[model samples]
Target: MRHYVAGGTEHGGGIGRLIGYILTAQPQSAHDQLVTDTRGARWSKLRSPPLLWAAMAVMVKDRLLAPDRVHHLHIAGRGSTARKVILGGLARGLGCTHVLHLHDFDYASDFLRRPPWQRRAIRALFRGADRVIVLGERDRSTASDLLGVPARSISVLHNAVPDPRQSGNATLDPPAPDAPARIVFLGQLGPRKGVPELLNALSHPAMASLNWTAVVAGDGPVDHYRAEAAQLGLSDRVTLPGWLDRAQTRALSESSDILALPSHAEGMAMAVLEGLAHGLAVVTTRVGAHEEILHDEETCRFVPVGDVEALARALADLVAHPETRAQLAMAGRDQYRNALSIEAYIGKLDAMHRSVSRGALRGASAQRGTV
Candidate 1:
């Protein structure tokens, strides 16, 4: 069996990373992909959205017509939703079964709050999908009630990351007793990711009193946050390195003691999963699918979203107590190995595509050696 996954190819974004994992985990001969969005460097004509969409439309037309190929579309809100609507419609019209994987972070404030025409596109997209994949149960209800998709057709599958432990650099040593705890934040520098709140939390008295250093990584208004960090007197200890490549991120994770996301909303953030996979004690909000898998003070630390004090306390506690931090980090890594690793995710994804024969299952398992 073959599956064609379509989505963005941005390195930092969730959908993009998911596609990367799928392409990387499964053999290319068994599974294929199409890049609907790209961080284009050249090819000026293809950079134009219309021309890119037209080119992809031709590709989709031919691919959907192929025999026994599963079409899985990963869609976010706004422009992503619009593009997939057309693509999914064409596939369905061609008598092909397609899966719609919803990764939109905003529905109430953004997608559902859109105008009538936008609502029409959203409705058309989900209702036509043969199977609908959501990152959590919250979205399962949303698709049923708002988009008129059947609840039975939807599946709640939290996102997963490639196991960092198996990356051959599994160094999760706790911070030295005399050295400051290392805190790393990975996400876009925007309000929804709680970057402003994270900076504020770091500047709080509780955090100020603790012995810690931080690196707020990811792309988005780096100068603005750097300036704010300076104003808060956190510039000395807090470093905003803009965006780190995968190698650099893995290195940061290896050297860091804690991973903090503190997003206001999420459909199961990749950073949190990555934190678990990398064996880092995490301090993040109990929003989205986070509350489902993570237990407060057990698997990882949990703080209330937008509450600077709570966030500060969480960070401070982890910073001060190395034993507690190490325990949580170990627990989180165990959780990753048991369920959230790419191997487990691929098994689930393969099942969603269809119940495969023994030979097909063997083929899927064979690619894990390559990863």
Candidate 2:
């Protein structure tokens, strides 16, 4: 089947990479890049005009429904209203199947909340889609309530991790003398990620009691987070290595004793999955989709968001008891192999594609492609 993995270049992370991998693995499937400007003036505004997007939509459809070819169409993670409708319109025009996979909670709703036209555009996209894919169960429930899509139309698929064949060793090993029980925070360095709260938690006496040094990975609003750390007097203990590439990030995860993510909002943290795969104890907040992969005191530990005291205490507990840390790490290893494996993800996606294709075919045969 020919899959068009459409997405913006801006929020390209594990999800984008996973999509690329799936398309690349299929010999017949050719991945197409629909590049669009994402640097909006406002934090939540359109980067380009609607006409340009409509033109791009024509281009996407032209490439997908090319003459003398058998192509099964699909678009991943609708970014903007124009882009979303453009793809859906193309699907309807070509009478092809389309999958509306969601990465964030609400893409079109953020700007299109009060506007009736925008809301209609979003609903049109939902109505045109054959299947809507979500990451976690909570996200699935929210999608149903917000989009008014039937429960059966939406599928809950957990983000999966590709196993690193080459474990860290001689060339790329964990931090030497992994003493002082170092911890790492991997992901975007933003306010919603709770970077400030983590710094505050590190300032407490309990965190200091553990002889811990932190290596913070990833980048976003660097100056702000650095200033916050300095203000809390955590500059000495915390190491801001900025953003590292995939290999470097994995090495840091392997070296650390614990991975902490005090995020205030998250779809599902890929860093948490990587830390678990690396056999490092994880300590994240309840805001994330951890309920799908983790159990309190089993595969990982949990704390309330922005609670410095609770975070400090959780870190102290992990640092103080080596046996507990080891047990959690072991459980994390098991969990990664069981639920978050790449094989499991492939199976889920394959099933979704088949189901959606069949549904679209049936819908198209009846009247039009309004699946």
Candidate 3:
């Protein structure tokens, strides 16, 4: 069967990387084709409405013309605009079964805040999908409640990372007592990532005596965060390494004692998954798939969103107790193996594809009075 995957291809965002993984994992028989929706250069702003429409139009036309196509379209993005365009317009008009994979944590809140007409439009787009793939239990509940879709129709698939244990670079040993604990944050350095708050947390009085260093690694306004770090007198302890490649990120993660990301929102952070894969003690806010995947003080430490004092205390506690960090790191790796491996992710996706394909065929046969 032929599968059409439509989403950002060139953008350096998580969704684009997700599409890359899906493409790489496809079996030979699937003959999957990727339809580029947005380019990386245009990622900072919304693509012109006419341009997006034209792109979707071309994708729909190509799918319609393909021979022996199963018409399994998987669209990944954050907002309802792309969903409305593809599922509501192209997929509906072409009678194609589609999967709506949501990657944003604030989708429910944003959906509720929209005008009535727009809200209805968004709901209609979600309801039209053959299957809705959400990142966690919370997102599934939100989709069911706000979009009026059944919970069974929504699959809670957490993002996965390759097992770092197999890489032979994972640091399983306890941290050296003489060395300061290293905490690494990997993602865009923006307000949404709570970089400012993280700086504030590091500057708190509780963390004054903590022997630790933090590396903020990712692109976006590095100068701004640098200024904040300097103002907090953290210039010596905090390192802004700009953007690191995959190998670099993996190396940093492997060497680090803690992976801290206090994001305001997320669907399922790949960085967090990568951190867990590398067996680093994770300290993050209770957002996105975190609530479903992480156990407080067990697999990782969870703090309230935007709480600087609590974050500082958590960091201090982890740094002062290396044994605790080691325990949490090992537990986080175990959790990754049990629940968030790449094999597990692909298996669930394949099952969903099979189910959707079967239902589509059944519907077609019934329409022809042959079933």
Candidate 4:
């Protein structure tokens, strides 16, 4: 068996990193080959230009049709501009099984806003694939509507994370109970992340009732966000830690009581998953992927997007009710283990590949009028 997995790199705390790691863990032997095309991933973008070009060439070569060899093709996160063109042509040329993984909802949004010539080309690229994999039902429905694909063509695969277990590094201690309850935001800090509102919300009546310290652990448009926090007199309350490695971020999650992110837009938040993995309850908005996983008063508490008062109230609820925090944490940990395990994810991927392969064989036989 051969498996080809391709996707984005971990940029601070993106879901792509987790996906890449999960794919790499798949069983590989001397006979079974695994090829990864990370040409347009975050790591490749930082490498020398010549090496990047070479990697792209290699990816294109690997993606080409191989007669009699069952190919499991995955296009995810970022690929070259010619990636879809090459892969689609390969599928048509060789009729190999193809899988298109949609990480962001931007593709369909672009197809709608762009001119007809561009939209037609984009549509054709998506139409050529045998299957499309998405993180949740929301993205699946949106992609289907814009691309004119049937629900059957799309598979809703929940983003998988490692079974959340405590990294028993004795030196790493949970935050002191006497210290302010830690509130962490773990993503690129930009306008889109709702940093300004988070800052403003810190000064709200409900938030003022509790003692909390904020840790912002990502880099992007930092100057503006820092300035806003200072202007709101939240400089002391918020810590702009710039960026943290995975281990460091995990430590923060284990130590934190509340994972606060009032994102204006998100497909799904891997950080929220990470928070759950570490047994930290979440406080996020209702839109995007949050609605898919979280139930208010169940896994975590939620408020409407952009409502600072509501966000503050939710935060206060967690702070004042320590038992609630403990309960949510336990529930979130269970959710991650039961539904988003690496074992479950790999099983799903394997099923998709086999189903597509079998369907392809059946179609070829039918076209030849073989009963």
**Maximum-lDDT candidate:** 1
Question: Which lDDT tens digits does candidate 4 get at residues 98-149?
Answer: 7776665244454466678755755676677777777777777766887766
List, residue by residue over 173-246, the lDDT tens digit for candidate 1.
Answer: 55557998989999889999999989998999888778899999998899999999999999799999998877
Candidate 4 residue pairs in clash (backbone atoms < 3 Å): none
What TM-score, over all chains together, does every model reach? 0.88, 0.81, 0.88, 0.84
- Candidate 3, residue 156: Cα displacement in angstroms equals 1.7
lDDT of 3 by residue, 1-371 (tens): 32333345445367666655556555453355444453224454555455456656655776568522344444434443544445455766777667777777577777777789877777887888788888888778888987898777888878887776675676667566799999899998987888888889888898888788999999899988898899889999999989887678878987898898999988889888888888889999888878788899899999888999999999989998988888998899899999988878878877887898788888889999998
- The models' CA-based lDDT, in order, is 0.77, 0.68, 0.76, 0.68
Task: Assess the local accuracy of residue 46 in candidate 4 as a C-alpha lDDT between 0 and 100.
Answer: 60
Ranking of all predicted structures according to lDDT, beginning with the best and ending with the worst: 1, 3, 2, 4
lDDT of 2 by residue, 147-224 (tens): 677888888887776665333251234444446887899988877788877888888888765667898777777777
lDDT of 4 at 110: 42
Give the candidates in order of TM-score, highest first: 3, 1, 4, 2
Worst 10 residues of 4 by lDDT: 3-12
Q: Candidate 1 or 4, higher TM-score?
A: 1
User: Alpha carbon lDDT of residue 69, candidate 4?
Assistant: 41
Question: What number of clashing residue pairs does each candidate have, in the order they appear?
Answer: 0, 0, 0, 0
